[model samples]
Structure formats: structure tokens, C-alpha cells
Target: MLSKRQSKYFKSLQLKKYRQTEGKFLVEGAKGVEEVLQSDFEVEALIGTSAYLSSLAENLKSKAKETIEAKETDLLQVGTFKSNNTGIAVVKIPGQDRNVVEEKGLILALDAVNDPGNLGTIIRIADWYGIKTLVCSMDTADVYNPKVINSTMGSFTRVNVMYADLKDYLSKSDKKVYGALLEGESIYKTDLTDGIVLMGSESHGISEELRPFVTDPVKIPGRGGAESLNVAVATAVVLDNFFRG
Candidate 1:
């Protein structure tokens, strides 16, 4: 059973301000918590049932600083989910300065995507397509938000998310920039082999500040008249085109 202070501390991780202040975030669900255990991220605590803890590899069980066995009741008490919850972990957020992106590597750059679920789905898509670096404007959804973390499932462990000034990052670069726009050329007609793929928020399209940096503005062709594709759906389609090319 968790003490009052311990429960309070874990509960605080659900909020962005507390997560930032503590330099930690919560990773919920069996897959997500398991991935964090396997990765280089530091796990401060693991809260789960006895059966869940017993199922982990011995080495993985040993890596965590602390492990507290709890029932479904405790999981419900502290987790963001209402049901089907298994585990929740308090883990250290890795520094964003890691130079993981190689020169000429294909990257996904997000503008001001505010939806946490969209951000999470985007991370999963990036992982699915073998893209390792995901850069977002400082205004993009917080990767550590509980919704985003839950949505990633487990891909959060594989993708490196960097927050920076999009304009500053793209303007000084020489690589191709493909901006997905409603009024741009067909993505099928463009070469997406290299450079950054810039996507915008769910409500707003790509920002004007970043337009000057786009080498080629492209869009997905649609026969039916839908207003526009959802950001995550559009990103998946765009990435699929890149894969098909």
C-alpha cells in the first residue's frame, strides 16, 4: 500500500506543471510501463499488482528504484484511466538535447498541434514508419501529458521528441521541407525521401512563420469532399506516401 505522501506525489505527475517542476512524468498501462523499464529512462517507482510485477523479467524488476505492489483499487485511485488499468510508473524525463537525429535523416516536425492524443498517435506513426526524430514547436502538446502517454501505447520509448523554435530550426537548414497544406501540390507527385515533413495543429494549418522554410508544399489528394484530414490521420497518410516513394 502506498503512503499518503507517495500517492500524492504520483498523483501530481498527471499535471504538466508538476511534471515539469519534478522533471518526471507518469507512464501508465502494462506496455508503456514495461517499455520504460526496458529503456534507458530512469524509473523512480513502479505501482502495480503482485501478478503484474511477477511477470516482469528479473533484471527489469531489479532496475526500478522502488516497487510497490497494489491492487486494482490502488491503480484506479492513482491512474488517469477508469478501467483496464494495470500499472503506473513515475519515470525521469530524458534531456531533449540528445543528438539522435542523423544528418539527412527524415524527421517529423509538428507546428502547434495542441491535442495530446494527436501528438501520441503521431509518435506511434513515426515509430511505425521507422522515423526516430520528432521535433515539435514549444507550443505543441506536452508529450508527457497522461493522455499522450496513454495514446503512445509503447512507442514513446522509441521516438525522440525535441521541442524548439520551428522557424529558427527550419530557416537555417538546407534540407527539403515538405509542408502539408490543403492547397499544395499532391504529395504523390513529390519526392519525400529527404528532409523535414512539417504538419500543423488540429484546428490551424501550418503557421505562416514556418511557411518561408517549406521547400515543397504538398497535400493528400481526396476524391470525396471532407473539410480536411485530422492531423494524425493526415500524418499517417503523408508518411505512407513517403514509404511508398
Candidate 2:
């Protein structure tokens, strides 16, 4: 059973302010909890029903500093998930210093992607393509937001997401900045390379400030009658082209 104080603390992690202050975030659901346990991330506390806890291997169970048995109702109340019967793990946020940006490999960068779902899907997409490092502008959605973490479906454990000044980072980098834009070279036609694939927000395309940094403005040619593709979908399309080329 979870103590009142512990329940409150776990619930507080749903908010960005509390997560930042505590340097911890909540990973809800069985899959997410299991992935976090398997990853290098530090699990501070694991809260789950007795059945869920017992189902885990001894080594995986030992990963948590503390484990508490809770009812299904308790989990639903403590987490952002609508239905959480399996578990929720309070995990320590990894230090930003550990993410070292390299100039050689393909790196995905986001600008003002405020949608938590989009950010989460992008992380999963990045993981699928085996792109390890994800750089986000300071204004991008909080990666640790429960919505973001949940949407990743455990891909958050594999992808290293770090927020920085996009402009400054772009200006300093010698690698090409392939900005996804409406009026730009078609991704299929352009000679794709391993560099920074910069994507913008859903409503607004790439911001003006970051435009000058885009060495290669690329886009996916559309044959359909859609105004624009969702940021996450666009990312998957662009990355697929990059992977193929």
C-alpha cells in the first residue's frame, strides 16, 4: 500500500514544475515501467498491484529503490493514465550533460513542437529509425510530461532528448540543417545525408529565426489534398527518405 505522502509525491510528478524540481518523472503502465527497468535510467520507486509486481523477474523488481503495492484505483488516481492497472514507476531524469551531440551521425532537431503527443511520437519514430540523439528547441514540449512519456510507448528509454537554443546550436554546427518547409527541395529529389533534420511546429512551419540556419530546405511532395501533414507523420516520412537514400 502506498502512503499518503508517497501518493502525493508521485502524483506531483505529472506536472512539469514538480518534475523539474524533483528531477524525477512518472512512467505509467506496464510496458513503460518494464522498459524503464530494462534501460539505464534510475527507477526511484515502483508502484503497482501485487499481481503486476509478482509477475516481474527478481532482477527487474530489484531495479527499483522501493516498490509499493497499490490498488487499481490508487494507480489511476496517482497517474495521468485513464486506466492503469499494471504499474507506475517514478524515474530520475537523466542529466543533460550525458547527451553529447556529435556532428557525424543523423540527429533529429525540433523547433517549437508544443504538442506532447507529437513529441512523444517523434521520439518513437527516432527510435525506430535508430537515430539516438534528439535535439529540441527550448520551447518544445516537456519530454517528461506524462502525456509525452506515455505516448512514446517505451521508446523514451532509447532516445536521448535534450533541449537547447536551436539557433545557437545550428549556427555552431558545421553539418547541414535540413529544414522541412513548404517551399523547399523535395526530399525524394534532394541528396539526403546524415545531418540535422530540423522540423517545426504543427501550425507554424519553421520559425524565421531558425530559417537562416537551414542549409538544405527539404519537403515531402504531396499528391493529396491536405493542407499539411501532422508534424509526427511528416517526421516519419522525411526520416524514411533519409533512411532509404
Candidate 3:
């Protein structure tokens, strides 16, 4: 059973401020909850319906410090989507410092990629390519957004996302900057160094504010009528080549 105060607190997490203040976020759905359970991040509490609780009783029993069986409606109140309330797990924030940017090789940087789904898909792709860290500009979408988290499909467990002053970070790093651009040299023909691969927003390419920081600009050639490729698709293609090279 969920107390009124608990329900209110969980629901408030949907807002960014509350999540920041409490240093916790809600992970909804079975896959997301399972990821949280398996991840190193601390689990604060777990709430679910009886059926949902019964389904994962064994797994949730050990990892979660507190587990409460509540009505489906109560679970829905705190969940991002009302369609499926498999479970809701309150996860402590992973306190990531800016120092992670100095880590070597193929760091993916996002320049105002606003779509949550696109951001999540990119994170999944990054995880698959073994690029464990992502640097997002301050304008990028929130990593913990429900849409972003849902789209990641549990790949978030292995990826570390950090927001920073991307332009300044790129400028100062000794790592070569490879920005994806329209008129840039073909990715197939270019020689990519072991460094950061910067991708841009869906609507706009890399922001003008960051263009000066790019040491190497590359592009994927296309013969199609479309103006450009989707940022997520482009990211996959670029990472694949970078990973293989």
C-alpha cells in the first residue's frame, strides 16, 4: 500500500527540480526496473501492484531495501505512462562529475539534440559500440526523461552520461574533434583519430557556437533526396566506422 505522502513524492519526481532536489528519479516499466535492479546505482524503494510484485518477487526481494505492494492505480499515479504499470523503482542519482570528459577514445558529444527518443537511441547505440561515456551540452535533453529512458531499453545501465560546457570542453581537450557536417569530407575517405566524435541536433547541425572547436569535420556521403540523415542513424554509422577503424 502506498501512503499519500509517498505517492506525492514519487509523482513529483517527473519534474526536473524535484529529481535534482531529492537526488532520485523514477524508473518505470519492467525492463527499466530490471536494469536499475542489476545496475550499481542504489535503489531507494520499489512499488508495484500485487501481480507485478508477484512476478518479480525473488529478484526484488534482495536488492531493494523497501518493497510495497499497492493498487495499480497508485502505481500509475507515479509512473510516466499509464498504459503499463509493471513496477516503479526509485533510483538514486549517479553523481557524475565533469572530470569524466578526460577519458580516452571516441567520446560522443551531443549539441542540443532535443528529442528524448533520439537521445536514448543514441545512448543505446553508444553502449553497443562500447563507447561508455557521453558528453551532452547544457542544452541537450535530460538523460532521465521518461521518453529518453524508455527508448534506451535498459542500455542506460552501462552508459555514463554527463552534461557540461561542450564547446569549452572540446576546445581544451587534446583529443581531436570530429564534427559531423554537411560539406565536410566523407567519413569513408577521412582519417579519424582516436578522439571525440561530436554529433549535432536533429533540426540544426552542430551549433555555430561549437564549430570553432572542431579539429576534424567529417560527413557520411548520401545519394538520396532527403536533406540529411537522422541524427541517431548518422551517429550509428559514424560510430560503426570509428569502432572498426
Candidate 4:
């Protein structure tokens, strides 16, 4: 039985305004909820249908501020979006700090990657290769965007995604910066080290303002004239080639 306030709160979380006002976001599905439960995030509430609640009985002792068990119909009633039948959990959005990247192993910087799925896929790609830190331009898609969360396939738990002024960070950074361009030295031939690999937006390559800061301008060699590759695909190719080698 959801209280009237709980109903209102769940509805509010659907909008970015409410998420910002409350400093929280929503994670859905069994995998996503399990990721949140096993992560360091502070969960606020867990609401589930009776069927879902029974499955989580062993771990449901208020991992959050409140755990409410409701009938399947009730859980579906006030759900902000289509509840995937796996239940829903709300967790505090992790506070992101860009300065931490300066001391980390390898950090990825996104210029203005606006697609939520693309950003989420890249985050998953980063996690696949153990690249934990990500710095994005302010214009990039919000990591907490539900679409992005869904796309990460639970990799969000292991990755830290932050937004910053990419140009300024690149200019001030001590790490070697490599920018992927269309007509530069082949990425296969470039010497990549433990540093930042700057990936650009979907439509455009690295922005002009930040291109000057690139220590090594590299390109992925291709045999065909396909114009270019998808940003997330390009990221996976670059990270796999460098990290697997």
C-alpha cells in the first residue's frame, strides 16, 4: 500500500526537476536494482509487487529508507513509467567530481556526446576494459537518464561518470591526451599510454576549441569509404585495441 506521499514522490522522480530537487534518481529492472543493492549508493526506497517482494525476502531488510510491499496492481498504479515487473528502486545519484580523474589510471573524456544510449554504451565499454573514470562535457547526456541507465546493463555500478568543461580539463591536464580524428595518424600505429582518450560527440569529432590540446591526433584506419563509425563503436574499438594489446 503506497502512501499518498509515496505515490506523489514516485511520480515526481519521472521528471528531471524532481530528481534534481530531491538529489535522487530511479533504477528499474532486476539487474539494475541488484546492481544498486550491491553498490555503494544510498537507496531511498524499494517498492515491489507481491511476486517481486517474495523473491527479495532474503535481502529486503530496509537496504533503503523504506521498503514497501504492494500488490502487483498497486505497484503498477503509481509507477512513474512502465514498471518492468522486476520492481523499482530509487537511489541517490552519486556525486561526481572531475578532479579525481587527474590521479586515476585511464580516464575517458567525451566532448558533447548527447545520445543517452551512446553515452551509456560507452560507459559499459569502459567498464568492460576496466577504464573506470569518465569526464564529459556539460552538454553530454545525463548518466542518470533512465535510458542511459538501462543501456549500461549494470556497468554503471562499477564506473564513475562525471561532467566537466572538456576543453579546460584537456588544457590543464598533465596526462597525455589523444583525440580521435578523421585524418590523423592511424590509431593502430599511435603509441597509446596510460592517459586520457578523448572521444568526441556523435555528429562531430573533437570540438575545435579542444582539438589544439590533443597531444596525439589519431584516426582509425578503414578500408572502405563509410564516412565514419558510430561514437560508441569507435570507443569500443579504441579501448579494445589498446587495452587488449
- Compared with the true structure, all predictions reach lDDT values of 0.87, 0.93, 0.86, 0.81
Candidate number achieving the greatest lDDT relative to the actual structure: 2
lDDT of 4 by residue, 180-215 (tens): 888678888888788889989868889999888888
Give a tens-digit lDDT track for model 1, residues 1-245: 77767888888889999999999999888889888899888998898888888888889887789999888877877778887446888898887556355555789999999999999999999999988999899999999999999999889888888888888889777888999987889988886677899999867899988888888999999999788889999999999998782
lDDT of 1: 0.87
Ranking by TM-score, best first? 2, 1, 3, 4
lDDT per residue as tens, model 2, 1-245: 99889888899989899999999999999999999999999999999999999999999999999999999999998998889889999999998676777556899999999999999999999999998999999999999999999999999998889989998999999898999998999999999988899999989989999999999999999999999999999999999998782
Candidate 4 backbone collisions, by pair: none
TM-score of 3: 0.93
Candidate with more favorable, higher lDDT: 3 or 4: 3
Q: Model 2, which residues run further than 4 Å from truth?
A: none
User: Residue 169 error for model 4, in Å?
Assistant: 1.2
In each prediction, how many residue pairs overlap at the backbone (N, C-alpha, C within less than 3 A)?
0, 0, 0, 0
Give the clashing pairs for model 3.
none
RMSD of each: 1.4, 0.9, 1.8, 2.2
Q: Of the candidates shown, which would achieve the greatest TM-score relative to the real structure? A: 2
What's the distance in Å from true for residue 96, model 1? 3.7
TM-score of each: 0.96, 0.98, 0.93, 0.91
TM-score of 4: 0.91
lDDT of 1 at 192: 66
